[model samples]
Target: MLDIFLMGLLMAQYTYTGYDASAHVAEETKNASTAAPKGIVMSVVISIIGGWILLYSITAAIQDGSEAGLTTLNATATGLPPAQVFLDALNNPTMAKFLLFIVCGAQFFCGMASVTANSRMSYAFSRDDAIPGSKHWKKVNPRTGTPTNSIWLCIVLSSILTVPALFNETAYLAVTSVAVIGLYIAYVAPVLLRRLKGDKFKPGPWHLGRWSAVIGWIAVVWVIFICILFVLPPTLPITISTFNYSPIAVLAVLVLSIVLWYARGKKHFMQHLDKEQLATDEKKLLDEIDD
Candidate 1:
């Protein structure tokens, strides 16, 4: 039973890793890939330390000679559901409060870090006019030299997300997992686009050169694999609605909208795709600012 639960936890961690990698890249770190890499490394280090500490504490507790072997659940004593075992703490009030405070601090810090990345992604998508509500999401306040509209949009979206979670925790995880798959698929696009380079493949500072073709092909396949893994049903037997596929469904709608934007209606929507020049200009402006 422990082995099975642990396996599920590891798989869930993979989905979480998938979700975080995007923010680590083009969004949060901007041009500083190394910073994102370092942040990820540090996060892993801290998490492992925390896990080790928890393991040692549990080991000590088990040795204390409790009938259930110091198991927080104490299945025999509590007679409550296994889930509530962890909540049944043995700590003193003062120490328990301190632990709660530390937990809150960690969560708040995570929120701050996540928001920084989310806002940047919103800005980037808006700048390219790809988001549905581009004007607000991509908007930049000249006075502040920042994307104020983008920041507000993020707040609205985050608030909206909390509504669903009020109903169920599994709902939230399933939904978020699905959304992440679509984002991953979008991320793989540029990597695969370099295959023929056709005519408009402008080489950026991060060029992979002769290996660029191979990289794109490899990345596209990897993305597909990740998407499949993420979209799988949470239960042993895979079924369509059993787990979250929201991201793929969302991406499907976006793709349809994009098609109409280009061919059927909303011609202005296609303009964003024609803005390779924006990336070029943005890069130049950044170089000048650095100079």
Candidate 2:
């Protein structure tokens, strides 16, 4: 039961990673405080409902009683992926290919959206000189009004980071672990910082009110627990093939970031929203007060 729950929790963490997509696009959104949160919630709810339906359909398809379906569903013997099960169950090459193509297209778009969100977030952070190569990454194309450099930066960095998958047998586990753990840590950091600020924390346009502290604490605790669980070896007798490298990868990046910040980043880095021009509401309030 414990093992089953652990794996289930791991999957949940992976699925929830990109729900912050709306937050990344806040700059371009109208009524951002309201809209972004709704976007996040809607995205998650839709994913859950859609995923359950798809899972049911796949499971049903596999029980078609055909010889090929039974063989492919025998995962231990066939060594087939879930998509192969679909192909075998249908027993029609053309239809199976079409269905697989649709799935692949959806996945491609999902990945593209995620990359878009990530690059935008990176661009925003760098605009405040928070990243190591701020000047380069923060550049917005005059014609396109997009952070073209930051987009490529994300693409290049992601490509480089994923190179280990080519050589490692359990690479998917390591990669997914790193993603789940790192994003949760990122999600938790500001919550902890807000907690530290206590009463001095300013209420946003969409503040949580009385439940803020409770929710924040719960998030912090859960994230910490997840991080610890993910870092530990998934199975005993860890070897080169079985070992999880996610914790090591995360720590390496963390250390490198710290070293870079101390060496050069601190001097150029500006506090987020400290630049008056970027504070739209504050600027409006100040103008009204002056008038």
Best by lDDT: 2
Candidate 2 local lDDT, 1-291, one digit each (tens): 596578668877787778888989988898776788788778988989988898778767765456675555665343545666666678887887888889889878878887999999999879878887788999999999899999999999988877877776578788888989989998899999999899996655556689989989999999999999988887779988788888898999899999988977777677544566568767674554344
Clashing pairs in 1: 178-247, 179-247
Error of 2 at 275 (Å): 8.1
For every model shown, the clashing-pair count is: 2, 0
Candidate 2: the clashing residue pairs are none
Cα RMSD for predicted model 2: 4.1
Choose the strongest candidate by TM-score: 2
Candidate 1 segments whose C-alpha is farther than 4 A from its true place: 1-90, 142-144, 187-223, 236-266, 269-291
Predictions in order: lDDT: 0.59, 0.81
TM-score of 2: 0.83
Model 1: how large is the Cα RMSD against the reference?
Answer: 6.5
TM-score of 1: 0.59
